[model samples]
Target: MILGRSAISMAIGIWSIVEQAVAQHASNNRAKGAPITKNVSMTRAVYTKLLREKVFPAIRKKWPGRKTTTIMVQQDNAGPHVQDDNADILEAGQEGGWDIQMVSQPPRSPDMNVLDLGFFLFVAVATIQDTFDTDGLIAAVKSSFAKVSYHTLEKCF
Candidate 1:
């Protein structure tokens, strides 16, 4: 889900994903550069489902008999968000007998995480180009996101 706020002079979009990508650039002195766009990879329910379906399956497929492998869960330092959703994933991993580790992100450090900056800039560029039509926006977003590999993202920022 996307939560947005647009008033006289500011626009902000926040996604359900615990991780956030933020980008800021200037078009003019007085005008806000651009509305910050947010991307959420997986929500709690979705993330849980992915753990049950995709992650577990991939792990089992790789090492069928062996029950242990190092698994890492990386997340930003948001207490409420982590408590609400991420904790469940951690608990489920333990119950499933998977050796899992949790990596808490440093607070207020979007730059430390590449995905945040990269993904946000990609979305912003796509949205700006796509302001005309809904379908066009989707296509643009998809194209931009697809191109957001390490090299492309670096060039964008």
Candidate 2:
């Protein structure tokens, strides 16, 4: 799931909420190798696609008349994330007439990330009354993400 909040306006932008199907484990009696339950990890390819196909477009739509030529996307220092100078990303940005740049946050700085600072807590509170299965959890998360107010987000900054 990808969620963005505007720096100035504190507007929320929910780009995508994709769920990965869990791999089923085989019967315990079987001695043969079986697929273990897997959670999809974000890779450079997935991140790049999220930026090019989802994030950028949502940003453009959010501020229709504003110049988006110098948009900067801030991300955590994850191993699978693409570097700022990645060729495909640069090309995509250029094609969209945007000067998109991926910037990594300072190491171990949870304070700098709004999601870490407050959003997750807010979501947790919101979801306290709900009970859900795996797929329902995804839906609940997405719903909670949408319901978060701009004022709440602004306070986190």
Query: Cα RMSDs of all predictions?
Result: 13.8, 5.0
lDDT of each: 0.49, 0.63
**Model 1 Cα lDDT, one tens digit per residue, 1-157:** 1101111111112213333233465554323544344544555565566555555455545545545655554556644334423566667656557654445667787554655665677779778772653445656766765665545534433
What are the per-residue Cα lDDT tens digits for candidate 2 across 1-157? 2234544444435543355443454455333354332345677787788878877677667756655546666777788777878898778766646665666778788665765567678557766756444444555666877887767767776
Q: What total of clashing residue pairs does each candidate reach? A: 0, 0
Candidates in order, TM-scores: namely 0.45, 0.72
Worst 10 contiguous positions by lDDT, candidate 1: 1-10
Output the TM-score of candidate 2: 0.72
Report lDDT (Cα) of residue 124, candidate 2. 77
Candidate 1's C-alpha runs over 4 A off are: 1-68, 83-87, 94-98, 131-139, 150-157
Q: After superposition, how far is residue 152 of candidate 2 from its true place, in Å?
A: 1.3
lDDT at 111 for candidate 2?
Answer: 66
- Evaluated at residue 10, the lDDT of candidate 2 is 42
Any runs in candidate 2 off by more than 4 Å, and if so which? 1-12, 15-39
